[model samples]
Target: MMRRIGLLIFLGLLATLLIFPAVRAEEKKTDGQMPSLTGNIEGGFRLVDVDGSRNKFREHYNLDTGPRLLNLSLNGNYRSSRILDDFRLQANGVGGDPYQNYSLLVNKDRLYTFEASFKKSDYFYNTITYPVSRPDGNQTSFEEAHAFGTSRENTDFKLTIKPENLFKLTLGYSRMEKEGTTFLTALTTAVPPDVTLITTPVDEIDDFYFASAEFSLSIFDFYFEQDYRKSDNKLNFLSDPTANAAVELHESQTVKESLQTLRQPISRAKVHTLLFDKLDLSTNLVYSNSDFDVDINRPKDQFQAVRPPTTGEGSLNKKIWIWDMEASYSLLNSLTVHGIGQISELKQNGNITFTGSSRDTTEDGTVINKIFSHTVGAELEYVPLKDLSLNGGIKRQFRKLDFTRISQFNPPPPIENPVILQSGDTIYTLGFFWKPLTSLDFMGRVLIGEFNNPYTNISSTDTENIKFRVRYRPLRTLAFSATHAERNTENTTTFFKSNFKSDGISIGYQPVAKLDLNVGYTLQEGKSFSFFSSADAACFAFNPDAVNLCGGVNGAFVAEYQARSNILSADALYAITKKIKVGLDVRNIESSGTISFHFSDLGVFLGYLWPYNLETKLKYQWITYDEVVLNANDYVASVVTLSLGLNF
Candidate 1:
């Protein structure tokens, strides 16, 4: 078995050290006669304890709330003059609980290199609620009572070879596996609206293989890469009314199963050359193709009660291509010019078929899309004074898109009108950097742009963006900085218009050599207005003739909203002695708008260093998260962690 072979190899590697005599104290320094092998090994262990709901805390930090091993890590490297110039190994877990990560690497000066790694992570979706609208226009809610989450494992291996100065090759492989609990909601066609929350099990696996080559010469460079990926995803859901009775199942118990597979191949090539010292040129091309197949089986039909093991099958094929070229030239010692042109094309074809005891149907479609863009820019940098430096840049860009779709049936698309979605924008930017004195510095930038959708005259927009920063260091121990940024978009379209602005200031001071302090605050604000159009009315309203409009030609204003956010933070660190230090940090953030939330964290830590490369640290943190509109989701918790490390 592979496991046995791996274990034997690991043990053999560990045994080699016994025959190699211990490094003598006098041989710490490298002498010219022999190759010196030197490396450091450090191991750390941490313990975490939480006082409140473990799931709540775990959702945020991905750590166990109760007693758990935070980390048991080891890393080391050995170097020799032989073929194996360097060999390194790192491990972070005991492979028992929560997660694990491990990696191994080997390198030879210019011949070859190899690496392998494995990692695992967990994800949780704690809150899932279902809301139903009543006849009176009120909404009723039902929340999931069971825990839902998933865990993923990933593995990667790679090898590289470079036998000569002009050529190099690389090969790699990776795999990922995920297992989890998922939730789904369903509706019954009963007179009195009925809802069912279905708990499901999910299993997925993905694998990828890739290879690349590089060629370099005095005047030219070329690189090529290609990769293929495959994935299998499956889900199964079965119902038990007795266990989770948010509702009473009138019909047969629910059962569902679904599976999907995807295959993708991607490739890219790049070539660049230095025509001259002042001008450099590069070109790149990329292509990708993807195929997907899916199958689903359910006990009962979604639209009707009849069930003959309703089944559905679908498949999709997608292909894309991209090409780009760029060039840059140094017109002067302090000025430079650059330009880039790019083109992209995408094509997709898909079909789906459904069969049941009473009904059968099929739908198919194909779409083709393309985009072209060109950009040119130049930058200037000059230092007119010894303490002052000015820098600015201007760029112009043009872009266009074309799209077409053919389908057997009409369905609501992402863009109602493809022509209306095709757009182009022109942007300009300029900025300056000035440092008049050692204690003072300033930087500012301005951007202006215009967007036009030629198919529809009403869908154009004008944009303005500005940002500035200033820093003043009035004293040797204290420094202050402030920043302001704003972006305003004025849309002539019927969709929406918005403005966003942010201002912030920060200060850092070290009154004494051993103590340091930092504090900062930021404010962000935004305003937007949504105006409905005739097309929107035709899509959203049942009776467009019975409504008053914005200007009689277009629909009315749907909403006008303003949002604001404030954030404040402070941190302090003090060194009690050369080997001991203490630090504290506090942060508060609150946002109010169409969506509102508030979050805060306060933490304190203490660290100590001892002889023989030993260190210890203790930290405690308090965190709070709240949704202003939904107080039931509010959570506050405290966590404490202690870690100890030793180096050999």
Candidate 2:
């Protein structure tokens, strides 16, 4: 509530300032030219219609293009040297399944500025029909119920002050509200049949406050910032039709309610400076704290005593602190060196209670997760000729995690035990740019990285990446470009390795002054091998009777797959007349793998401009999707849109 009042007051001040005229319309300009507002206001209305399967179309595409609606679009700008230096506002919205946005900005000289904006969106969750098989090798189709939908709104306001050359300040605030219906699953397997399937209605709100200031002088600059946020959520669970029969068995208490809240605060300080014109340094420190609380209410009549809500009435508190310093030095005319050191510490403590029929029990504990890291690197550049340059760099990073977990659930073992985890990586990179001819250019780079983790002895990885690009413009109206990239990761943990490679090319041609054409194609392929770990809990459940099948420390190779994909896209636009233009875009994507699928879409539009600043546009698009293994989910959609606009 306070945030809303603050925002309102801020806007009120801007409104008051806007009431005064910047200057008289008849006033003469100092430069011997009349001063007037130079901006265009455009108003438009759009008509959209959807065809084909609603379920498939609605899910695959945004609702604005899938439904019938009358939309509005407005944009304008104003500037003056008197009361306000610059001002702008924009608003647009769709009527049906409306998504709306509004924003305004005003600036006076270079000292003060104000901004406000709001946005909202509506979403839908449609039901689906699929085949449901029975244990007796029988299959039947079932249509799921239509669940509830969701809506969200957000608002933001900001004020800036730059009164002097040495210091500047900015203050901003934002709020968000979300309300929707969501599916809820039972927490325990012991719930009654009717309570297994439920729906949760949700209403949540979040607020944020931010403030930052910066001061600079000569070669030194400093910044200080703070941020605070709060959130509250209320949720209620109710039995759905699937659980209707079970609801009758327990009629007294059929609803559960939960309330949750979170509060967080963060602060940061940073400083940067250059010394002797040869070395540049910067440092930053940050601290953040968060508090979370949740309360649940369950009817005693509906739920049994054994599952008494797991009632937790306590709050959790967590804190994090981070500090980092970075430095760069110009070692020579063609070389520079850079290094950074950073550390982060995190701590969390919480206590929770479980309500039982006899009494309530409480468990409390704390955890510390700390990380220290360092990085150093150097870069070199050599230009022997005007058209050729070579660049190379190498960086090494080391990190250590001193983590301690001593909670009620994970008590420390006896006999003085300690554990620490450490990991780091080294990276090397080299690249070059060469222009052999006036119309030809080439660029390429290579990167290699070696990494180790706490489990490095058992599992580690090395990665290599290479990319090259070339462009040629032999003609004034034509250009061609091509690129190739490859990456591979080799893991020693369990004979796991993966590789990806891609090649693409594009051509742009301007046959005439009013026409342009562009086409591009890409091909990608990937291969990987993965071993299934028997230690996974799911393995035990899958083969309980035959433990030897997949229940050992050294799991067997369970999966190996290769994936390949191709993408082709083209666009062409032409100006038939001074007031008319037409354009077409086409895209096709195909994939082959264990999970193979294909998608393609084509769109065309025609635009016309009439006298008196009037304009009209007509667009049509078609999209299709196909699945080799699951054809039931494939569908096609055709859309048409028409819009009219007027500019003043």
Candidate 3:
């Protein structure tokens, strides 16, 4: 029903646009003058052909063949009218495409203005691989295969009154919806748990309304806004009985879940001021409160022999507050200083209850959680010369978390003790920009930081990053640019480390007035080390002493992987004649590591401009993708598009 409504609205707008030009033309003929309506409309058709796996092609690029409204733009002005002054309309990708957008704007010459827009997008994901042998001679692979896809839509409308320089009032409303199907894996409740694959369908919607006011004065500006939001979500999981039918003592089950949330009101305020023409200051603040309710239902099945059908209910109340301030001042003729500070806090409280055929429990004990954080930073910029500028800054951040949980038994056991954790980080940064020559420029920046988090092994204790770039344009028709970046991080407690480096360069040439050419290349390398435990080793180890040495029978071991990638691209365009042009583009990407792949794309286009405000274009594209280990996932595709446009 919603999709039908959206289509109706779009068709109505399109009809109005098509008739506007005719009406304006009639008026122009009567007045013996040109009309004020001006713009262009373009429409096209697309064709697609695939030689390999169609699922892989869809997963990589979700484009389909169809008739499409490529683009449209229309603008009209009424100079002698008293109620309507000007209006504009625009649309793109309007027919049977993966993505579409439309917008309209109208103004009444200082009294009021209104705007509306709509957008839709589609997503797809599908990848299947065969089983492989593990290092310990155990087979490891996914037990199920499926394709997942979804679509999302967004709509918005806004209006403003007295939209001038001094003060303006605005009201707006927006909605977002997502619906699709996916896959999930669950474990049965038996002694030796069995894995089961389930198909899941999801639906979600969110809506928001807001009002805002803005005021501007001689040396200061003020702004304030208030908003409200509501959300609804539903999910269904259906078990595949045949997923584990061959395995012994396996059963299938299904589940249903729903959630509803509301945020009554959210408030925001901001202020900006300039003092003495040398000092600038700004501050902003926001606060919001939300409530959520959730329900889950599980049916009785073969796996639930010891238990009956179960139902659960949960509720949560959350609140958050944030504020930030910034200021900058000129200390000398060649120096400036800036400072920034921010603080935020979040709190949540919730409870849960469950009921079944054999048991009924209402654990009303509330679960509470809290988080707080703050940051401060300062920087100074100095320009000692007309061609050189330097800046440096330091920042520090601190955070703390506290939470408590209660047991889910009848009468609710005693509330557990509250747990607290704290973490912090400090960073220093320096940057410089220099333009010593008329045709040459250079820029660079560096950062160093230290972090402390004793509660988690994945946290890094120290980190460093550096980046540099340079550009040279020795002549009017030729130019060159290069960039390099590096990052390193390590955890001292767990002996975990990672590093990344990248470099790129590009050159552009236009030796002739009618031709243009460009080429570029980039290389990237990265590596990381971490620890993991293998279940096969844990089940095979028998000696008690050996088990103790293997991380308490988990057989934990260090794992490492390295990856490198190279990318190359080239393009050219030439004006073959006075009314015709041709262009070509090519790109290739290759990577080698734990998982290797290669991708190539080639495109060509031809454009022609005819007499009497008419234009036509033709384009073709070819793409190929290959994986070194998963040959079944490889695919090749070809696409062609033709378009025509008319201007008035």
- Model 3 local distance difference test score: 0.75
lDDT of 1 by residue, 1-648 (tens): 135325423633563353123322222354322334333333333345555445555667655433333343333333433344555655554333356666667676678888877777777655433233332454435411344677888888899998844578999999888987755554455556354556567689999999999998778899999999999998676664333332221222448889999999999999999876888899999999899899977555443456456677878888888888888787776666666677776666676655553433333444455555555565566656666656666666565656665544333332222531455667777778888888999999898888776434566788999999999999999999999999999765445679999999999999999999999999999998765543245423422332334344432324456779999999999999988999999999998976577889899999898997677878888888877666555677776766666655
Q: Clashes in each model (backbone N, CA, C under 3 Å)?
A: 0, 0, 0
- The superposed Cα distance between candidate 1 and the true structure at residue 527, in angstroms, equals 6.1
Tens-place lDDT per residue, model 2, 1-648, is 235434543554454344323233323443322334333333344344445344445556655543332333322223434455555655555344446666667776557888888777766554323332222343323212233456788889899887744477999999899886654332222322123445666699999999999998778899999999999998776654454322122222347787889999999999999999989999999999999887856433232435344444667787888888888787776566666667676666565443532233433334455556666676676766778888888887777766554434323232222347677778999999999999999999999998766523445688999999999999999999999999999864435679999999999999999999999999999998654543355433423233244434442224466889999999999999999999999999899985577888899989999998777878788888876766655777776777666666
- Score candidate 1 by TM-score against the native: 0.73
Q: Candidate 3, residues 519-595: lDDT per residue as tens digits? A: 99999999987543444453223322332444433324444667899999999999999789899999999989855
Superposed by TM-score, candidate 1 places the C-alpha of residue 113 at a distance from the truth, in angstroms, of: 3.5
Give the lDDT of residue 10 in candidate 2.
51
Best by lDDT: 3
lDDT minimum window of 10 residues, candidate 1:
18-27
TM-score of each: 0.73, 0.75, 0.84
The Cα error of candidate 2 at residue 55, in Å, is 3.7
Question: How does each model score on lDDT?
Answer: 0.67, 0.67, 0.75
- TM-score, model 3 to reference: 0.84
Q: Give the clash count for model 2.
A: 0
